[model samples]
Target chain A: MIEVAGLTKRFGPTLAVSDVSFEVQKGEVLGFLGPNGAGKTTTMRVITGYLSPSEGRVRVAGYDVVEEPLEAKRRTGYLPEAPPVYPDMTVVEYLAFVARIKGVPRREIQTRIEEVSEKCAVTDVTDRQIGKLSKGYRQRVGLAQALIHNPEVLILDEPTAGLDPKQIIETRELIRGLAGQHTIVLSTHILPEVSKTCERVLVINQGKIVASGTPQELTHRLQGYETVLLTAEGPAAEMMERLQRVSGVNLVEPRDAADSRVTFEVHAEKGHDVRAELARAIVESRWKLLELKTSGLSLEDIFLQLTTKDLGEGPDTSDKSSVVGIV
Target chain B: MRNVIAVAGKELRAYFHSPIAYLVMTVYAALLGFFFYSFTATYVVQSFRIQAMGGGMGAPPMSLNEYIIRPLLAGVLTVVILLLVPLITMRLYAEEKRSGTIELLLTSPLTDLEVILGKFLGAMALYAVLVAMTFLYVGYLFLHGNPNAKPLLAQVLGLLLYGAALLALGMWFSTFTKNQIVAGVVAFAVFLLLFVMDWVTAYGSGRASDVISYLSLTKHFDNFAKGVIDLSDVVFYVSVVVLGIFLTARSVDALKGRA
Candidate 1:
């Protein structure tokens, strides 16, 4: 229900978003995965009609964001990075105000507020001033305001940020519950939030889309060939040569050798699993097989490889670097 | 229209919930009350002295409208509103910008004109309430003495237009920055400049001075205070109000780009 084409936003000297293009279909949940300053929020702002694109155009529900902003905005709900709330207003008052501006019918306003507050789990604090609530509740109130109008398109930026682990899980479940009803484009740095909640993922870096696919598709695409680690008691050079000759094996390199025991990393061609054949050959050749396991790339590795590898640097190999810190 | 009312209603509620409105009202009531009592006391003393002298030197008696009500409403209240209006309008948009609520408002379906007009109307409503409080003194004068209601009504209309123009100007400045202190100070400075435009023209009466006097905010109120509602003066106040609202709308639109 949303189409953003050639959107470029220039803030004086820095280009916050440049030539970005993407489309989100109706009832599809698209996860926007990017590190901080990856133009995720900028793109969201453009789509929500908060910021006009310096170039190109955005259309929401078939209405141009710049030309027909009111119509476009009427059909879209946006939760900015910071929940835009008045500290002095109570939860119910704030939601009612949002509903009013969102063009929710007056007669249905009360029911709509109740429904969203229930959905977002903010009903308990309806009478309390928003400033008095905890961060989790305040964030839920923010979500409640966004959903108050029941807009067809929902754009949320970092919906789970700053929440406790339990709150994060609850929010993820809430967003998942919204699937197939509202077209959603949620930007987040958390990896599992995407894997657990999104149907498709778009990885953006440095104001450009680096990768776009399903979670499984991204992992499989990044794993161009299957890798198997084999530990055996054999001469390193001969074993490496014999392992390469095995069917479906593309490359065999000796990883380490100590006395008679050596380990070889076998890379099988894409779409091939030659573990059974390689194990039989190793046994038939009279080499003592100590360990053999298939190693497939995880989404974390794929995300790192796609975002950071293109910077002319291999993935950082430190213990802390193994975690997905960027996206 | 509903969008405008929605925004305006929220803003009006915000003003009432905060202590600033009450604080301004108290200070205004005390100052205006003191001015009214003192001006009437001075008028009464002069009247008694004239009666004691048996209408000495053929001096005509001073009308309460000329000597007391006109100065109280036009002179003293103008200054009171000058000091209080910035306080009323400083947070209209600046608070939204500081707290990041501008995002929600801008992203909503409301147009820039609707948002600006809503804020304008909200600020006007508060100013109206504050100005309305002074009418109690007017009501007392009507009950105790013979006072012409025509000029009184004219002055009330004049003050409404005058105060609205100032409120709109203050609202426009509030939209230019996220700092309320800056907005208030700059709005006061601009209001002060416009307030003194007539005085500045006193030094000379050239074409430039004539233009300055014509542009003076206080200049147009003089005719209304005298119970003469000239269309030009009405048009002038309306023009300023329109100018202020238009600039504020443009500023709100500008905020989206800066966002």
Candidate 2:
């Protein structure tokens, strides 16, 4: 439902977004994963028709944002980083105003207001002035404003930035519930949010799309080798020698030894499951097996690997074995 | 049109919901009321003095339109509006930009003209209310005196147009900055300069003098206060109003590129 091609945005001489391209299919929830100042917000703004791209084009629902802004804007709902709300107006008043501007029929404005207020869980504060509401309520109100028009595409820039933990969970649930009905593009620096909510993740760094794939794919692709953490009551050097003898074992590094238990980080060859062999070797050796678990690279590790790579290197450097070797 | 009204309605509510509207109205009413009292007192005193002279030397009875309503509308109210209009308009775009609400407005399906016109009309509505309060004071004159209604209506029309022009200019200034205080101060300074622009004409003559005198915002009101609705003055104020709106629309458009 949204396509951004060669989208480059510059503020004066500094490029905010550079030659970035991506698409979110209809009803697909796409997550923009990046650290702060990663051009995620800038790209979202260009897509929402708030800021024009300095170089390329953005289309939403088949309408060009620069050429047919009204049509594109009509089908897109945007919640900016700051939750564009007037503090003096009540929730209902603010929603009604949004409904009107978004072109909800005059007769349907009241119902639409109630509908979004219910969906965003802001019904309780409908009559209270927005300025008096808590930050969570205000953020929800911003979401309600974006949903008031029932637009086909929703562009949210850091939809869960400042919420308490409980509120964050509730917001994630709300966004997940919205998945099949609305095409969503939400940006966040929080890694877990992408794994939890998005069907596809676009990892952006330094004004570029550094990586893109499903959450599991990102982890698996970046992790070329398998790592297992094992703790056992054994002689550390002897156990390391014994594990190194097992087939497919690349290296065995001792982590720590305390209370007669030695922990080892075992690295295996790619696509190798050394757990069974290591377990059998430990069981037959007369050493008590205290702990054995496969410690795969989590999304946090993958995100750090993708974003922290040297800026001068190409994005393909992320998939190189040298980088994944550390993970 | 509906989009315009939506934005306009929001702007109007923003004013009423905040203390700014009430504060401006109260202060404006107090100042105009004080001026009305002083003008009435001076009119009464002048009329008595003329009566004591037994209408000697062909000193006709002081006309209420000349001695009271004219100066009150053309002079005192003009200065008062100069002070209060900046307050009404300073937040039109500045506050929106500051609070990030401009994102909502610009990203909506509404055109830049719709948003700009809506804001212009919203400020004009509040200013109209401020001008409307003068009617209560003006209405009292009809009860005890025979002031010409024609001149009163002309002065009111002139005052509204004058305010519309300044409000538009103030709104343009508002679009330049996110700080409301900065917008208000800069707008006030420009309005004051426009009010005194004709002062330079006293030192020069010919076409340059005429042009400066014509550009003086206060100079155009003289004909309206005298019950003459000169088309040139009407066109001048209308042109300024259009110019302000046009410049503001361009500024808002430029925001899309810069922001």
Candidate 3:
């Protein structure tokens, strides 16, 4: 439903998005995962025909955004980072105005407004001034306006940014319900939101695509450098020495020692399991193994690892393994 | 177009919903009313003096339409509009930018011309309301004295065109900045400069003076106040309106290159 090919945007000297290419199939929900200033909004703006790409082309519903902006815009609905709403107008007035400008059938505008207001759960605030509503309600009104015309594609930038926990869950469910009918590209910095909502994720960093896959695939790919925590009854120095001798153990350091019970954090080599080896070694050495904990890299770890690293080293390369670090 | 009408309707509703519209209307009506009463009193006093000198038998009476009403409607009304029209036009685009609503407007399917024309029509409609209130005073004149409808129509037409040209110019300046105060101030400065071009003509007598005098909005409006609907004057105001509209369109188009 949407195709962005080699898209690049430059604001004076800063390259907001650089030679980025991506595609969304019909009825697929693609999560744009990136930190702030990662060019996600810029790419979305280009796809929606709000901003022309400085270099390449963007097509929505088979219409080139630059050449046929009106046709492309007609099929796409965009909610910018900030909800573009007028405070003085009531929710119904704002929605009606949007419906008119978006070319909804004159006779069907009222019904369309009712349907979207219901879907977004903003019906009660339809008569209330938008300026007086809470932030959550205003956001729902923003969503209502976007869906008023029933566009085929929805481009939402950080849709659940400022909502409370309950509103966030409600909005997430609302977006999830919208899948399979409207192709969606939603950008977010919230990690769990993507894991629950999106079918596929594209991790972007420093104006480049660092990784792209299912949430499970991303976690599994970065699971090679999982860390382990061990508690043993022995001298701290002796435990560190013995744990370092285990095969696949890259680094070991004592965390703390109390009553001769020492805690150690063990860093293992990629794709290596040193837990069993260390446990057996401690038992043979007369040291009691009190507690052993091993954990795979979480999505938060993967996100921080992907974005905090500098570009031009290995993250920007197409090789997936090169992007992995001390996750 | 339907899109244009939709935008225009929204903008017009916005004007009435805010306090600025009523404020401008009240202030405008009060000023015009004071000027109308003073001009009529001065005309009535002058007529009495002329009659007392001639013994009041067959002395010719002064024409109120040419002497008082025309200047009040054409000259004073135009200046008042030039000062107040910014309140109507300043928020046309500037408020949208400040409030981040321009994103919604530009991303919609409507074209730039539709948005510009719709806003222009909205501002003109509000100005019409302000101008219509003065008709109450005009009606009072018709009840008491006989006046020529031809010059009256000419004055009304001239003021409409003059006000439109000013509104268009104000819209153009509003397109340049997101700050409404800056837009209003700059619009005022530009209109004042254009209004004073006739004085520049007095300082020189060459081709420069001719161009300055031609560019003076007051010079063209003077012809209309004198009961002459010259084609040249009509063309000048129309050209100004067209120029303002295109400049506004260009300002909006520049956003694409910078976006």
Candidate 4:
């Protein structure tokens, strides 16, 4: 339902969105994952017809954003990062206004407002001024406004931002409930939100698509080195040295152990499970085996590796360097 | 037309609820009262002398209700409009961008022209309502003085035309900057230039002087103040308003692309 081709946006010497292209089929939730300045919001704005692209075109539901903006917008609903709201207006009034602008039929406006408010779980605060609502409720109101018209395409930018853990789960459930009914392209800096709510992932970096695949596909593609943790009652350094000397054991580092017990993190080469070897060696050495477990990397590690831009063997530490203090 | 009315209705209602609008209305009513009372005092004191000398101030050929009061009103109200219109219209688009509401409005199916026109109409409607509430002064003048009614009617029409032009200029000025304070100062600066164009022209030589004078807003406004009601003056103000709206629409479109 959405197709973007060679979309480029430039402001003087700064290129906000480069030559990026992607497609989102109907009834699919595509997660756009990136760091702070990854141009995901810029691309979404171009598709929503809020910003014009310097080159190329974006089409939604078979209509060009620039050439047929009204029609394209008619089929699309957008929730910007801030959730544009008026302090004085009640939730219902705000949603009604949005419906009016979206050209919802006058007779059906109230029903549409009710439906969206219920779907977004904002029905309780429908009569209260939006300015008086909590952040979570305010976000739900924003989502309600976007879903009021029942558009086929929804583009939400950071929908779960600033919400509590419970609110985030509720929002994810709401989005999941919307699956197969609309094509959604959601952008977020939070990798876990994508892992939980989206089926497909599009990773963008510095105005370019660095990777795109399902969560499992990406994890499996990058799942070459297997990690295992071994806990034993033995000399920590000696056990680490022994494990490191093993043929399939790529690296071994000693971790903390209490009560004369030693813990080591062992990384095995591809297509090898060094767990059995470590267990047999520990039995032969009369070392007591405490615990053995496989260590799996999270989407966080995958994100860090894909976006670190440099091929390296050490644990990625760049996530801390990208912190921008709120001034 | 539906979009225009929907957007305009919401904006017009917002003006009523905003503190700035009420503050401006209070100040305006006070200024009107001050000027009206001051004009009455001056008329009574000055006309007394003329009447004693057989000039027949009482029951004279023209009453205080005549068109002479229009100029003083034109001057006072023009200054008042110069201050208030910028405040009312500056938030039309600038505040939207600052508050991120512009994104919501722009992402909708409405065209740039629709947003500009809706805001323009809304601002003008609120201004007109403010102007309309001044009808108490009309009733007061009519009851107290047997003024000639023709010129009063002409002057009212002239005020509407001149006021429309100024509102449009103010709306256009608001679109250029994100800061309302900057929008206000810039709008007043723009008005000041047009307000003082005649002075700048006076010091110059040749037809440039005449051209500047003709282009001055005050110059066209004066015809309305004097109850002249010339078509050229009316057309000139209307053209100014149209030009301002056109520029505003173009700027909105340009901003969406560049900003």
**Model 3 C-alpha lDDT versus the unseen true structure:** 0.88
lDDT per residue as tens, model 1, A1-327: 999889899888899988888889999999999889989999999999988899988999999999999999999989988899999999999999999989999999999999999999998899999999999999999999888889899999999999999999999999999989999999998888888989999898788887787888777656667889999987677777778889999778787889999988888887898998888888888888899999877777676766675575644332223323323
DockQ of each model against the real complex?
0.57, 0.74, 0.77, 0.70
Better of 2 and 4 by DockQ: 2
Which candidate number maximizes DockQ?
A: 3
In candidate 2, residue B160 scores what lDDT?
95
Give the alpha carbon lDDT tens digit for every residue of A1-327 in model 3. Answer: 898889899988889898888889999999999999998988888887777789998999999999999999899998987899999999999999999999999999999999999999998889999999999998889988889999999999999998999999999999999999899999999999999999999888777887888899888886556579999998778878989999998778777888999999888887787889989989999989999999667788778777766643432233345655312
| Regions of candidate 3 where Cα sits further than 4 Å from its true position | A253-262, A311-321, A324-327
lDDT of each: 0.88, 0.90, 0.88, 0.82
- Deviation in angstroms for A33 in model 1? 0.9
Q: How many residue pairs clash in each candidate?
A: 0, 0, 0, 0
Best candidate according to lDDT: 2
In model 4 chain A, which range of ten residues has the least summed lDDT? A318-327
Residues B93-189 of candidate 4 have per-residue lDDT tens digits of 7778787888888989898778778888888888887787566776687686677677666767776777788778888878877788888888877
The docking category that best describes candidate 3 is medium
Return the top candidate by TM-score.
3
Pick by lDDT: 1 or 4, better one: 1
lDDT string, candidate 3, B171-212, tens digits: 999998999999999998888888987997787899989988
lDDT of 1 by residue, B124-178 (tens): 8989998899888878887878878899888999999999999989999999899
Error of 3 at A92 (Å): 1.2
Report the lDDT of model 4 for residue B50: 72
Fnat for model 2 comes to: 0.94
